[model samples]
Target: MNKTILSLTGAVLFATGAVVAQTMAQSTSESTVAPQEADAASVARGAKAWTNHCSRCHNLRSPSELNAELWDVSVQHMRVRANLPGAVADDIKAFLMSSATSTGVQYSTPGQGGASVASFAHLSPGDPLHGKEIYSQTCIACHGADGKGTISGVPDLTAAKGRLTKTDEVVLTNIIKGYQSEGSLMAMPPMGGNPDLTEQDIADVLAYLRKEYDIAPGTE
Candidate 1:
């Protein structure tokens, strides 16, 4: 395991109390809707621009990875880091927030550039309600409704949470690109076999898993 990645991701999970409180306080129903309106052309234009510019530096994480406010912070920080123009950066930020519209459970993790939210800042306690839907769509086939595996070599989630030493980062990163466990023939396929799963979708599913299994928060 990469120690740096582990420590960084761990810190975000540990610091959620403050961010969540702040977000809920600031995000009133009226206040949220006004700033959240997306430009008619922002999504399409930003998506194209993101692929063209941002992908050059890092893996193209789905827009849902960071919340809009986090995205705003990241884009501004990156604008300076990457020397991006104001107009172009705004478009990129637009694309991100459109795809991953905030559900008000705001959590900020460390950024990719330094200790701020940037290219890699992700982890929302996530919406367990929405996560349940994603779980049914993607993970139900193999993991089942109760989180018990239906096949050989598959670990049951109820018990698997206790078995793994490194929970959140290890599991999440694997979901993105896929990986083989330390001693298993059954390699976890990328996106858990759902090719269309976005990073945000995966985050939701993880939130469900963490809640259902009582995994993430105090595990480490």
Candidate 2:
């Protein structure tokens, strides 16, 4: 009976060890992705939810409309009112915070001849790395991985003298509000169909495009 008891104890210990090892492996795998990437993924989800659900009721408020404190209170109140799941609400709030107008995100614009101007100098520079991640998630569908249009009539982002040559304000505004190229069959959706994308997201994406395609000011 002592041997039987020892055998059972060993079996239980082995099973427990296996479970712990598996759990640790899973956690390590999850930890490999940076928090920013995880957050960007969450923002993508929130963008979908915000567009599908929140817009159904009324016009969606701009992220710049409220401060972070106000957004927290508003999101909490709306979660209860709309019966939004806790996770969804949290994502929406995250979206709002990341894109908040007051966040002061900015990027520098380089002219063709190597002159650097502080474009949107009021805000901090957009993250090109983060922008690439967003582009992969959102823009890559229409704009190919190469920044060239994948579908028919889509603009080639690499054009030596094309859209990127336009002023920053014009480009940014066109994206925020959605624009249909004069000859295109369809208009590009606002925020590239990800409503949760912040102005920062757009800026990041623009920066990514400019850098990835080498389309700075006069160079375009």
Off by over 4 Å in 2: 1-122, 218-220
Q: Write the per-residue lDDT of candidate 1 for residues 112-160, one digit (tens) a residue.
A: 2222222325556567788798777556644667877644455677774
lDDT of 2: 0.67
Checking candidate 1 for backbone clashes, the offending pairs are 111-116, 111-118
CA lDDT, every prediction?
0.60, 0.67
- Each model's total of backbone clashes: 2, 7
lDDT for 177 in candidate 1 is 54
Stretch of 10 with least lDDT, candidate 2: 103-112
Q: What is the C-alpha RMSD of each candidate to the true structure, in Å?
A: 21.4, 13.7
Instruction: List, residue by residue over 58-130, the lDDT tens digit for candidate 2.
Output: 7666555677568777988999999999788877776665555432221222233332333464545667899
TM-score of each: 0.42, 0.46
